[model samples]
Target: MNSWVNASKFFTGASTVGSIAIPAILKHAGIIGWGALAMELSSFFIFVIAIMCYMSMYDEDGYSSMI
Candidate 1:
């Protein structure tokens, strides 16, 4: 849960043309769009991948508690 939420925040910040997709959607439709949906999904998967990677590395490094 911790890794997921952290990754979520980081991904949303930089996804879709870098850090501004959600704002653009709000200005246009007062809601997010398909592109934004794509961004979220892609970002989420990428983040999950990152988390898995970090988890593996942490284990290798003998770090038990994840940040």
Candidate 2:
């Protein structure tokens, strides 16, 4: 369970980084619009907020699952 959770966290971190980086890469390559970037930024913040909420549902010892 711990391994799976850790792997999920790792992938989430990677995806968060990619969410920032891939947009920039696409814009630089002229494949996306400004509106698309704006949408991505908004969605990323929402994703972060959801992650924070999920984390806060657990206690410091990380034993409680209440999300």
User: lDDT: which candidate is best?
Assistant: 2
TM-score of 2: 0.62
| Cα error of candidate 1 at position 20, Å | 19
The weakest ten consecutive residues by lDDT in model 2 span: 58-67
lDDT of 1: 0.68
* Model 1 stretches with alpha carbons more than 4 Å out: 1-30, 60-67
Task: Estimate TM-scores for all models.
Answer: 0.40, 0.62
**Residue-by-residue lDDT tens digits, candidate 2, 1-67:** 9999999999989987999999989988999999999899899899889989988976676545444
- C-alpha RMSD of each candidate structure in angstroms: 9.4, 5.2
lDDT of 1 by residue, 1-67 (tens): 9999999888866664453455555647848666776777677679779988988877643555554
